[model samples]
Target: MRILISGASVAGPVLAYWLTRHGFSVTVVERAPALRKTGGHAVDLFRPAMDISEKMDVLPRIEELATGANRMTVHPESARRPVRADLTKIFSAASDRHVEIMRDDLSEIYYDATLGDVEYVFGDSITAISPDGEVRFENAAPRRFDLVVGADGLHSNVRRLVFGEESRFSTFIGAYLGVLTLPNTAGLDRELLIHVGVGRTAGMYGAPHLGDARALFLFRSERELDYHYRDVRRQKEFLREAFAGMHADVDHWLDELDRTPAFYFDSITQLRMDTWSQGRVTLVGDAGYCPGPAVGGSTTLGVVGAYVLAGELARADGDHERAFPAYERAMAEHVRASRGVALSAAKTLIPTSRLGVSGLAQGARLVSALPAGLSRAFLRLTTKSARLYNSMTIDDYPPSPAASSGRVGLGVE
Candidate 1:
């Protein structure tokens, strides 16, 4: 059977990798002309995702490229002194073994790992997807495959094509987030700085590679703003208008945003679908069940979903009828918990009032000064609330019968 997977980020490439190993021909189609270098934010890969990576033999390579932050500093936008955030406490609060990496880095790793075996069609997308698994390309002739998977991100073209529409499954989470690379102003020594104020928060952190820094802007909004996703120029102007009069290098960052070639802006939204599969076409990762961006579990969910889909397909000998439903059943509860945690965390982390910023800073200070043992205890306590958002290890899924199969065909058919 031949599978055409959309999106080349975490889900598509990983799914292609596994499907190729499972005796199925796999091809990945990405909208970007090449491997996407710009990632919206850094994502955490918990135990389950990491286990998947290790099984793929990319865990050691990931560790070699790990960018470990020493501490996180929280500050009021009006103040200069920052309250140091405890690194130990933050990591411990997660109930899973976690590895933090930039989204693009992970994408690159997956792309490179599967380049030899998987067919990658760049600068293309699906304009139409038939119920019988025929894919119409935006820039190429129509093609047919036994199975089609949408591993695309939040605003997925495949999901829109296969399903009725994206709005039906999308739920706005009352927040907006923007992230982009900028000049390092705070001279951070592997520390992340988060500034908070009334209904707004901005964060700056040094990246893992290239001495450059990246900035994150988040704000609480109950109403939708007229924003264009493709126009980066307008997005910069919107950001400046939102934060017109701010202190501590606000305009400087805005100026940098105007010049930076890599910038990302989006509202916090999750796709909640009743079913991930329609006939032979299925959606994976954000296209199906986005647990919200930058709130954890998104990457892990993608990895676990890919692992299960591939395993189930192999278990059923490429029969998607038996595979898709089982894949959904295995991941449904975990997806619900992860999405709920993301919604809840966004409400808690982003301050609602000016005073709330100060409160959050004090809390960070307290956590930073807590004893090591107490810090671990607090992490354990908070992690339960996070559930699979914090713990995403797939130790339960044993070695599949498909594991022995190798050198599967990746022909387009």
Candidate 2:
């Protein structure tokens, strides 16, 4: 059997790793020219994703590069007072079984691990996917496959071609987010400092390696402002306008935003799909069910989803008819739980009102005073109330194969 997968970042490569192990030929196509080395968003690997990584033997290396900043300071921008909350207290509020790592580094590691076995076509994308399992690439010739999967992001071309317009499934949460790399001018040492107020929040923290700093900007917006996704100048203007006349390093952040080539901005949108599989083609990760930027479980969901997919395929052998629905059954409840957490986390963490922030601060102080074991227990219960958040158990998925399918023809444009 052969499979064609789109988007190499997280789910694509991971699915390749497992499907190849199960003796299926696999090829992955990425829009980026190479393994992406930019973007510094911090990602946490929960239990199942971590376990999958351990089985893949990449967990230790991931830990070597993991960020260790466990304390976060929530400050009132109006009063300039630091809220006394540790990192665990501020970020998770209720969970303890998470490991944080930079998104780009994780992508690089996953890509490297799959390079020897998975065929990768970079700087290309699919223009159309026919039910006959034929893939037409924008920059390549068409090729027929046994199965096709869309692991592309929110704006997925594969999904658009096969599933219909994205407008049918995407729901907009009331917010916007922008992340960019900034020079370590503040001289932070493994700490995340957040300043929140007036429906806007900005924070800068040192890179785990102390190399440079990363600035994160988030705000609640009721209206959608027009801007180009690829136009940096326009994006900078939106950032400037939203933050105009605001306190706390607005001028310096605006200057840094203009110079940073890796700036990433997007709306907090979620994907609500009733089914992830269509004919022989399927969907995984954010392409099918993004809980939005509001949810921090994207990485975890992607990793766990890949593992479950592989296991189902192995159990069902070559029959996608049985495998696809089985994969959904195994993961649907978990998806719903993870999505719920993503929907609610941002609103609570970035507290919309002064009283909310104060109550959060007081709660953190109370939690911090507990003993080690007690603190861990309290966190497990209070944070991430979702039952499926980290409750992944890798079933009997076979190991990934050593040989890849190489590049297949995508019908010419």
Candidate 3:
């Protein structure tokens, strides 16, 4: 069984790793000339994802690279005195096991882990994918494989080629997220500073290991904004307008707009499809069913989805006819639960009114102020969605003899 996976960032490499371990030949294609090293922000991985990483022997590196953001200061726009919050307590209440790591770091860890075992092609992309596994690339000779998977992110090229335009299956979550990289500001080494207000919020944080920091913006909008995904100039203009008079500190942060090394902006949207598979191709992670962008536990979803898809293929003896359906079945509940939790998180984090903003700030203060035992219990009761990732249980699948030798046509592991 030979497999070709698209989008080498998070899920693509992970899926490739597991497939090779199951004795399949694997090749990964990435659009970036090399690993992307820009516009990354912190992403959380909960219990289930932690378990999977442990099985792959990458958890220790993940922990070593944790953002260590354990404290936060909230500056409410209403002139309320800033409130201090303990992130350690909030995360402990969210899950028994969790780590907040930079997206770029996480992607690199997985890519490095799978490097030797898989064939990775960078600086190229899939121009077309046929129903029978014939793939055409922009600068490489066409090749055919037994199966092709799209592990690409939100605007997956593979998804567009196979499943049609994204709007056909996307639902905007009434919000947008932007991130910028600049010299350290506000917080450092596990510290976070927030400027929160009704319908919009901004923050800056840095880690001791990083020479620079990141500025994050999350805001609510009644409708989608106008801008092309590739137009950096237009995106920067919109970002300036959105936070024009936010605060002196925010303006200071925005001053780096022209000089920042990297910037990221996108709508927080969800992908809902009746099915992720048709013929020999299927989708995984954000490419297939993104719960929602920043607010969603998309990092964890991507990890778990890749693991299950690989296990199913091995168990079915490389028969995607049997594997794809089983893979979807195993992940259905977790994906559904994650979507609900993400929606709630987006609304709560970026409130719709002044009162809502105060309540959100006070709620954080209350959670961090209580006794450890009491705070954990209170959080579990009032914020059940916070334990959203804890509700999932990982299934174990060992390498199998039933898997094909993978040397029939394309010689592989």
User: Which candidate number maximizes lDDT?
Assistant: 3
| Winner of 2 and 3 under TM-score | 3
Clashes of 1: 3
Q: Candidate 3, TM-score vs. the true structure?
A: 0.96
Per-residue accuracy of model 2 over 1-413 as CA lDDT, tens digit each: 77889999888888888776666678999998988877667777877787788888899888888877776676766665676656664334444465778888888788888877788999999998888878899898988888888999888888998889998998877778888887878777767777677667777777557387777888878877677778878877777877776665656776888678578888888889999899988899999888876355888888888878877876666578898999999888877877677766777666678876665565666676666566656666766633456455556665433223322223223
Question: Where does candidate 1 stray beyond 4 Å?
Answer: 78-80, 383-386, 390-413
lDDT (CA) per prediction: 0.78, 0.76, 0.87
Off by over 4 Å in 2: 88-96, 385-388, 392-394, 398-413
**Candidate 3 local Cα displacement, residue 141, angstroms:** 0.2
Candidate 3, 1-413: lDDT as tens digits: 78899998899888988988888889999999999998699999888889989988999999999998899988888674999999999889767899999999999999998978999999999999877678999999999888889998989998999989999999999998989999885547688888888889999988777778999989888899988899988988877877889899899988998999999999999999888988889999999999998888999999999999999988888878899999999999888888898898898888888897888888889989988888888887876465677778767878886544443233222
lDDT at 157 for candidate 2? 82
**Alpha-carbon runs more than 4 Å astray in model 3:** 404-413
Query: Scored by Cα lDDT, where does model 1 land?
Result: 0.78
> Which numbered prediction scores highest in TM-score against the true structure?
3
In model 2, which range of ten residues has the least summed lDDT?
Answer: 403-412
TM-score on alpha carbons, each prediction: 0.92, 0.91, 0.96
